[model samples]
Target: MTSEVRAAVFRPDDERIADAVDLLESLGATPVPDPMLAVEPTGATPAPADWTVLTSKTGVELAAEAGWTPTDTRLACIGPATADAARAEGWAVDVVPEEYSSAGLVDALTAAVATDESVGVARSDHGSAVLLDGLREAGIETTETVLYRLVRPVDAGESTARAAAGELEAALFTSSLTVEHFLDAAAERGVRAAAVEGLADAVVGCIGEPTAATARDHGITVDVVPDEATFEALATAVVERAAPSHHGE
Candidate 1:
């Protein structure tokens, strides 16, 4: 490769960075682990429901870790990967939103399922209230639980230094928290403006539109987003889109 073309892997704790790192490496860019967020168990027991919703793979993993075995509850996941995670835990997914966002999930469930059923949502401690709010607006009662905790790692803006040096060529954002904390960390390091410019200049990829919205709200341009919110697909999309920039050299 003509340039190192480092891409920031901005997911939480590098939990799912391997596949994306491999993909970026195959495309001739070195993947830098920029784990800006960390997750911890909240120790809060999740309530049961006739319909249960999971927004992230972490939620599914943590729920299963907490010995939450699905009884007769119908599972609704926010993305295909999340559905896969739910299935891996032995529960069949009843609904997955085609748009893969809060409003989309609520829309999908509103049209397809009976609204009177008891619904529950499991997510991280800082998970958005969007889905729960949207569902309630749609007349569906949802009990929400913080199944895990999300925290900004103390080293959040470690990569913003690279960013200031113009070394962050691209990045992948998996959640709103990642985008939020990445900026928070960058701002914490007193390079928020430079980091914002650098991110704007870099090829920004999001696993879903919700995250893209977060980036745009912060004035960062989003270059790639996958139809399916899977890490492999997002990584591939970013690489494919970055090819003409000589990233695959």
Candidate 2:
């Protein structure tokens, strides 16, 4: 007989949140769906290049919606999820690094791409400089096109409040931005210290090493960083760790 586990998820206010809620519930955790990130499309597509790199599923979907195509250019994705999104849109993914991070993209492209070839990186406005810098250092020409902007939703403080009140058993951070946005919300609510202190006792899960690093930088102890950098992995690991008695599901 396991007690209810109150877990917080900070995805966008879109199908992402719905899917995250479903996953948490299936794992027997009461999900606190606080949308921390909202996507605003830039209405600009990636420029034509020898190789085009996409870093997120949302970017892939947005590009598809804009009737964008590879047009003889090779497609590269930062992770399996982004690759899957592109594949679903009938785009052939040429490269997906085994590491699944900016550094990973840099290594993969550096090894495969020629210095003469140009790469276009399409992602959110908050995209990391690691990828672009890595490519540039390798002498490969790379350009970035902001596909969208990720903004903190106004109603994103519920999870921070829950954490401050010690009502949350776990928190799943999907990205570094989510961690920053969560802290921002906490600060805005005047409960940043309390929330960080409360989270010290609860399970904090980050989707990847970068997200975990961000959580730790904010004085939040991270307990889990799943091998796969995906929302499902992060949520499932957090729920299982927070409620060990209910693992069979």
Candidate 3:
């Protein structure tokens, strides 16, 4: 296809960026690495607990850097990607929910650990409270340790210009913060309305439903969302929705 899809990956630089870029290229799309979020270590660590829960790969990286590793405690992750990130550090993951969301993680934990067990939820500053509330409702004690903070990017001027001129074909958001910050950036660039209209012309894909919800709330319609909340899955969703000729038609 002569019309190459260009999708903005609005996430911080990490080990996953390379993989996402490679996937987009393989699908005949240009992977725009205009990260809309910045990663900052929170100086917090996930100490050993009865059940250690990891919410994102960033958290796992920070916790490992802090000299924390999996002990006899069971490891529960919010998604398969997070689980893989944990296992990369030699931690045995005991739970990876099929749903791949905060609510799904709670169900996995409720089934894997007894109500009397303590759960240590490790994540960044943008971590959700759904799991904490869900665990509490399940009669499980939970402790949260912030491992990093995602700095929102409020200047998508370059991306907005490219989009407004029709040089962009798609955009991908991995988190709600990404959606929020991208719009904030667009407004700062004085192209919020144009960006919204441009995104309508391009394929807008999100990593999951929550991010998609945020995008819609901000008046940006989403075209694709993967069944699984992983970078690879998101890329696949974008490619499939874009219908690149190289994707076996």
Candidate 4:
């Protein structure tokens, strides 16, 4: 049997979905695109700050949408891809920690900032508060701005849900919102049980511990979690899991 990967990409952009698809193909697995959420910028005004932290590429896109410029402030990114996105927007990246997480960014910022430097965080409305809390505890002035919001897709086709049920051998979740959106889409298609159980059997992969925890909360066991929470790392984990020895050759 050909190794087929059922991927649940919550990213709204086709390019993002294509990245997942390419990963699956490279592993000799057929990819099935089943996006569960759509990302939209909140149109919030950017305030002046000494430093700006970007947690996601979507957040970077939102900052661009709001006409924010890096020339006016320092930029810190949670991961290299986010940093690259910021750089693409002509922003200078001041810091990108070795570990790719908001907490990691906070730790890096804590070490770099003076006692009086005010930092602004651009992130989703719903996300972990670990970064904000850590920054505040470290005496760094932190202001969180909601940049983008994830909305569950209203038009999930039944065929996609059925694919999630019967054909997808593995599902990759990148965030908590992806998990929630997958559950919501599955429930809407009346395949909640199938979706959950199928994911449990399949090689469910997560980008980080937080996303893995979210999968666990939904009774979906994460079979693979990469060391770094980057797209490249996540793709590597998926490929490794699908390898013959890893899957019991």
Candidate 5:
């Protein structure tokens, strides 16, 4: 049997979807384009702070819509991709932690802020406020503004749902939203619990702990979690997990 890897990507753009495909192909897996969610930017608002934290490229795009420039404040990004987006928008990134999670970013920022420095965070309206909460506890005045919202795709196909129902070699999840949206889309397409059970036979590869936690909460067994939550790391984990086990030999 051919080891085909069908991924349910939530990104709508063809370029991003292609990137996911490319990443999967590099690991000797086939990429299936089934975006479960779409990202919509809400109107931007006035930013009020000396420093700004950006967790996603959508947040940066929203900042641009709000007439907010990265050069206007000290910019801190959660990871390299977000930092690249900030730099593309002419913002100078001052800090990007080794770990790519919100908690890691907060930990890095907690050490950066001394006293009386105000910071702003650009995030999704419904996402976690761990960074903002942590900054406040560290004595730094922090404000959070919603930049974008995630909505379920209008037409998640039945083929994708059926594929998810079968025994998957593995599934790679990038965010908590992906896990939630996948389940929602699956249900909308009438995929049942047996399909989710079939997925359990394969390794559940997550980009970070938070996403892994989300998977676990849904009763999905997470078999692999990358040490670093980056796209490259995710691809590497997929390849590594597919390798033959040495223990049984």
Candidate 6:
């Protein structure tokens, strides 16, 4: 008899988690929906600048909700997903980095904009410093607006316990912050070491290179990082690798 393939997902506690669960079920894996991240809006908007950069879909949504528009500023997104989100709000997206990361954004902007222009970055409080540092090093004046803060939810340790108990067949990590929150939850439950041990035996997948590096730095063995840094890609790759074991094939 085949055992159920239980996979853990660490998205925010929102519709994204529901979408992830549906995707996992369609892929034949039992979804372990543990929301390790929570969004706390800072109620601030980006100041007008020569160039404006947005990093996440959530930032775009928050900005739109606050009635902030990129009227005259040239807009650049860190990835296609954020660009799509901005476009959905009737904003003209001028540039989307080909690489879909902080470094990618820096490269795209540096090549497109002059050093004399100022850049405004609007993202989460946990936004990576690579983009700002790279832009500044290129002699472009840059400022950041914290659109929101990502905090771990209070009731987020179920997956940590499951992983430590050797019940999860796979784990999907979306960002470096999610990885950190998972470890924090595990440590809170006193299962940090055991959970890392269990992850060694399971297929662990991160959305991108930076997230994979964060997992590796914390002693977790990462098994898959897809070319596209998207949740669909991460979950698909992880389920494909973990399904064989659950099916006893």
Residue pairs of candidate 4 with colliding backbone atoms: none
Best candidate (score: TM-score): 6
Q: What RMSD does each model have against the real structure?
A: 2.4, 2.3, 2.5, 2.1, 2.4, 1.5
Stretches of model 3 off by over 4 angstroms after superposition? 153-157, 244-249
Clashes of each: 0, 0, 0, 0, 1, 0
Considering only N, C-alpha and C atoms within 3 Å, which residue pairs clash in candidate 3? none
Compared with the true structure, what per-residue lDDT tens digits does model 5 show for residues 71-103?
A: 667888989988998888877899998778778
Residues 1-249 of candidate 2 have per-residue lDDT tens digits of: 237789989889989999999999998899999999999999999999999999999999999999899987999999998999999999999999999899999999998898689999999999988889999989999899999999998878998989998898899998899999999999999999999998987889999887888889889999999987778888888888989564454
Q: After superposition, how far is residue 43 of candidate 6 from its true place, in Å?
A: 0.6
Q: Name the weakest run of 10 consecutive residues (lDDT summed) in model 3.
A: 240-249
Model 6, residue 62: what's the lDDT? 96
Query: Runs in model 1 with CA error above 4 Å?
Result: 1-3, 244-249
How much is the lDDT of residue 124 in candidate 1? Answer: 79
The TM-score between candidate 3 and the true structure equals 0.91
* Of 3 and 5, the candidate ranking higher by TM-score: 3
Model 4 poorest ten-residue lDDT run: 156-165
- Give the alpha carbon lDDT tens digit for every residue of 112-226 in model 1: 6685687888887776777888888888878998888888888667778777767777888888888888888887888888887887767789988888899899988999989
The sequence of per-residue lDDT tens digits that candidate 6 reaches over residues 1-249 is 336779999999888999999999999999999999999999999878999999999999999999999997999998888889999999999999888889989899999998689999999999888998999999999999999999999999899989998988899999999999999999999999999999997899999999999999999999999988888988988998888764567
The window of 10 residues in a row where model 2 has the poorest summed lDDT is 240-249
Candidate of highest lDDT:
6
Predicted structure 2, TM vs. truth = 0.95
lDDT score, residue 245, model 2?
66
